[model samples]
Structure formats: C-alpha cells, structure tokens
Target: MSRRSLARFVALAAILSMFGTSAAVMPAQAADQVIKIGIDLPVSGADASDGIPTQNGAALAVDEANAHAPKGIKFAVDALDDAVGGVHNPQQGATNIRSLAADPAVMGVVGPFNSNVAAAEIPVSNESGLPLISPSNTNPTLTKTAKYRTAHPNEITYFRVCATDDVQGKAGAEFAKTLGLKKVYIIDDNETYGLGLANVFEKDFKEMGGAVLGHDHITANQQDFKALLTKVAATKPDAVYYGGTTSTGGGLVRQQMGAAGMDPAKVKYEGGDGISDAEFIKVAGDAANNSYYTVAAPNAAKSASAQAFINAYKAKYHSDIGAYSANGYVAAQVIIAAAEKAIKANGGKAPTRAQVLKNIQNTSGFKSIIGTFGFDKNGDTTSPVIALWTIKNGAQDFVHQINVSTK
Candidate 1:
C-alpha cells in the first residue's frame, strides 16, 4: 500500500482498538457500579412492624427495577434504620439523611416513613439537592413552607406518593359528617404528624358545624390512655379522633376505651393514615370493628399492573401485600422512573444528584402502579384521592373513595 493509504489504515486500526477497549470496559463498569437509593424507615424499634414492611416494599421495588433496568445501569437500595430505641426519632432520621447525603453515590431517597421524621430529615435532603420521595409522609407543612420553595426553586425535590394530612383530615371529617356524628373528641400524640393531622381534622369537623366536645394530647410512647378516655367518655361524645400510629395509639383505642366502660360500637373511632394498617386491626382487635380510617386510595388490585406487582411481590417474598406496601412500591417506581429519564437525558451517562432532582421535579404525569402521578408546585401529589375504609369483621373494607381538592 502507498504511504497515505497505510497511514489511513493505521489510524482506523487505532480507533478500532480504542473502541474495543471501551466496549470491554463498559460491562465491567456496569457490573461494578450501582445507583444508590437511600431508605430511612424505623426498621428496629417499636415502629418496626410498620417500618419493616415499608422497607421490604422499597427493597422489592429496587429488585424489580434492577431486574428490568436498561442495559447500562443497575439499582441498589441502602436501607438504613431510622428507629431510635422505640421511636422514629427525627434526630435519627436527620442523621440517616446526613449519612446518605455525604455519600455522593445516592441519587435519591425513599423515606423517613413518619411525617414527624420527615419534618426533620427533609430539610437536609433539600439542602443537599437530593430528591426525597416519601411513600407515606402526609404533613401539609412539609411542602407549604417558604424554606422549601427557597431551597428547591427549580423543581420541588420533595414529593410524596400518598395524599397529605390536609386532604386526609378533611376526608375523615367528611366521613364523620356523613355518619351524622354530632360531637367528637380529638386526641393527638403531640408529635409533628399527630398534632398536625389532629388540628386539621378538628378544624374541618368544627367548621362543618359539628361539635368538638374536647381535645387532648398524649405522648407517643405512652401505653395508658385510660384517664384521657375516661374524660372523653364523660363528655358524651359520639366519636373519637386519634392522631397517631398503631404502635403508640392503637391499643389505647381498645384498652382505654374499654376500661372507661365505653362500648366499642357506641363510640366511633377515626384516625389518619397512621392507623390504617393490619397491625392496627390486630392491636385494637374487636375495638377495631366499625372503626374508620382515612388513607390514600386503595390500590385497585384488580388493575392489571397492580395485580402483576402483587403477584411478583408475593412470589418473591412469599408474603401477602399490606396496606402501605403498594404505596412504598410505587414510591420506588417514581424514583426509578425519574432516574431512568435523567440518565437518558444525559445521553446514557449516569446523572448527578442535581440532574436527578431536576428530573424528578419535572416528572409530570408519569404512569405508576398507583395511577397517573404528577406533583403540584408545592411537591404534593396532584391526585388528591382519599379513601374511607371501615373495619368490618376484622378486615378493613373499602367504604368509599373521595376525590378532594382545596379549590
């Protein structure tokens, strides 16, 4: 060959060799790498009963996401215990966030399951520009704050799969009104979640012209609420509103009310999403019967996508799906979808945390197992559908799905 032809051939060979080297390195990079997702839930304390399942649901989602991930990326979940002693402490939640944030590998976070915990940890994630999607946190104050807007101006980094307490409390009040409840006693656990939700319910119930017989507060770890129940029973209220989780508040519903000589059927009990679980039914037992709860709309298990998820979850874990599991799964789905979009937008390169946050905030009308989900400007789920369920014969049966809007 002539000198020019040989030079061209040598250049082509050098380019081909570089391409071969890069191709060989790509699979090793994919295999050795992982996209980290942080999970903060009370996995080892009093709240573990609720938290463990949520963690499991999140893990299941991660597994499924990895199994179906596009050729170049794999997902890994870093499940951290936010449970401190017997409580889901905000300090612990914040610590978890700091730890996750310090690691540059984590693209997003899945929780701090309790709204109380979210109150502490979300700001940290916000400062770090890490998108934190909560599966269960419902406090309205989270997304309504000026700080949230100031910190996350481009897109709301904080998103939730569930409806907020503003919607949940209103749904509870409406349900009580529908039942013709005239007078009700409100009790809260004094935590961020309990107090916030209780206040909302109390306001709405009273504004509806219903009577608020009395309101009380209790510590979350307290086991005895007989004195409070006695005072509430003396008020002759038609119903009682509990604003806390099953771990701290469920037994009070049955034991304290029974000790006060109040017949379970005679007094209606209502609570927010915290008490809407199978564990609450177990803890409250017979008292749980006829009790009502407000929760995010029930997973339409009949939907083909939902059923497929249920089946995959059951087959993988050999456990039945619970009230919060599907929500947790959907929360993971949202994060993964956002990450995938970000990666694609980055031309097959892994996205940085800022890019992921932007992608998540810009996520509009993404199809999820729960339904079509999009966040409002405030980071709240735009789909404000709450479901009222009644415990009948030891099972929570769906009563009605209420479509609510602040407008």
Candidate 2:
C-alpha cells in the first residue's frame, strides 16, 4: 500500500476505537441519573430532635440504594425541613409538602413526622397523587377517617411504617401498670398527637385499675412548666405521663423536677415517642436519668441489619444516627423498593405515583434495616413493635421491647 493510503487506514481505526470507548462509557453515565425521593421532616427548631434523625435515616437509605445501584437506577434524596420555622405548624408543613409535590422528579416522600402535619399534608398529597410514607405519624385519623377514605380510595397514598398511637398508648399504659404505678398525672400538648396519645393512655390506664391523679394541658412553645410541675408534684403521683415532644417534655423533666428542688427519682416521668429523642438528655440533664419513654421498636439499632445501617450511616456522614433515624431509613427503603418494582413492571419506564402507591400497599414481608416491614389494609405496619427506653447517663438506653398485642 502507498504511504497516504496506510495513514488513512490508521485514522479510520483510531476513529472506531474512540467510538467503542464512548459506547462503553455511556451505560455507566446513564446509570448515574437518579430517581429523586422527597424527604419532608423537621430538621431544625422544636421538632428537630425527631425530624433531623428521620431525615438522616432517609439519607442513609438513599446512600445505600445508590451504592448498590439496583437495576442500574440510582436513588437521590431531597430533604426539606417541615419544622424549619417551628414545630407543629400545619402551614409550614403544607408549604413543604407543596414544594416537594411540585417537583416532577420526586416520585414519593418519606416523612412529615408529626401526625398533625400528616393530617395537613394528606389532602395536598392526595391531590398530587404523591405517595408519602411516614416513619412516625401514628394518628389513626390520618387513614381511618371516612372523609380521607372516600377521597383517596384505591389511591390511598399515605402509609405509616410504625404502629399508631392507640397501640403505643395502650402498651405504655400496660407497661406502667406492670410497674405497679397506681396514681398517674397526665399532661398533653394539645396537638393531635399529644392529645390522642394522652387519651389512649388515660382510657387504658383507667381500665387497668390505675387511678388518674390529675390531667393538665401545656402549649408546645411554653418553656415555663413550673406551674404544671407544681400541680403534678402536689398530686404526689407515682408517675407523670407527658404527651408531647422532647423539646417540652425534656425541659419539664429536667427543669421542673430533680435537682431544681423537686425529687426526680421519686416520681417517674413517662412519655411517648416525642420524648424518646436524645435531646431529652440535653434538656432534662441529670433529670433524664431513669426517665422512661416509649417509641417504635423497629427504630432500635441493635439488630444486625440495623447495626449495618448505622455503620454505613456513620461511615457516610461521620455522625451518630438519632432515635428515629433507622425508621426513616426503612421508610425510604419501602418507597425506593416500590418504585423499583413499579418501574420493572412498566418495562423500564419510571413509575407513576399511582403504581408506586399500589406497590407500597402490596409490599409484604420485605427485609429492612428495621427488620421486616409490611403494611396492612389500614395503612399500619403488620409487625408493629413498641420499645420502652430509659434515659441513663444523658442517653437513651434500650430497656424493653414491648410486644404489641394489637394488630
């Protein structure tokens, strides 16, 4: 061959090699396009204790999903703080939900930790056909209401990964009764969650031959609980049940009682999941010791899968995962798994909100970092477990995992 002809052949070979290399890189690059999941939780302000951990858990799940890259589909989390301005603000919750729902890239949402927020966001979410799985919203009214069922039949996009307050309150009451606590002073924050749980505890405790010494109401933002504490102290009850978030509950536990002139060890202060956060330690200080609270058992980090998740979370974020972090992570897992299932069923197309909702409802016996998770017809987890914890040395230490008798 002539010199010019040989050079032309070499150039053609070089062009083909470049094309081959480009084709090889395209698939990996295509896999990098992530499916975004919306995370609406309280990352700051009053509810940050629960909301931040919930967000962290969701982030952990997103990281795992991306690392595993199931079916070449990457997962991305878009976190929004519902309690950015303050806690228990329905308007802020609605705003956050609307903002997330407006994003076409967001296939589903992982939170809105407060039941009141869930109540507010349900209508907006239903209108947008957005599937929202809450890790902590346990109010029965969210799913059981006739209005909610009528408006969102077959398309019920709201689901919870934890047991409702009915179960939580009953379990808590039973636990206290077992401890031989006869007279209990009950207090609530007046919000949907606080009031609802308080009612449940009151009814159950009464039924179990326990006496209600007194009942009081407290606002969410009130820092001065001395008046209520004084009343409770006067009652001389065996235990004080606080139905509110850690922000108020912890402060009341620390400042109102204990070294602040009240005998902390003499009276047991019990609360629901709201007071189960580590912030309770900071707020309650030494009073946190021996303080008992109830929370979703599935959120514990003791299981093998949970420990794995915690390790991965720590490795990625270099921080301690909070109380509800594992539950939120599992919530994200449910959403992502459903999305993947829907996508596969739709012949590699991204899932529709409706399809994803169905997938979430039908999802059963799936292994998660929080153990087995599956929802029943009422949008409640089938294996709902409640755990009691006590504050020890300014930290929440697992005490007993309450086996839920109710479905």
Q: Write the per-residue lDDT of candidate 1 for residues 359-387, one digit (tens) a residue.
A: 77777887877777788877777776687
Q: Model 1: what TM-score?
A: 0.88
Q: Which stretches of candidate 1 lie over 4 Å from their true place?
A: 1-30, 147-155, 405-407
How high is the lDDT of residue 37 in model 1? 85
The alpha-carbon lDDT assigned to residue 103 of candidate 2 equals 80
The C-alpha stretches of model 2 lying farther than 4 A from their native spots are 1-33, 70-72, 86-88, 147-150, 258-261, 405-407
TM-score of every model?
A: 0.88, 0.88
* lDDT tens readout by residue for model 2, 162-219: 8788888998898898777999999888888888999999999999999999888887
Tell me the whole-model lDDT of each prediction, alpha carbons only: 0.80, 0.79
State candidate 2's TM-score. 0.88
How displaced is residue 258 in candidate 1, in Å? Answer: 1.2
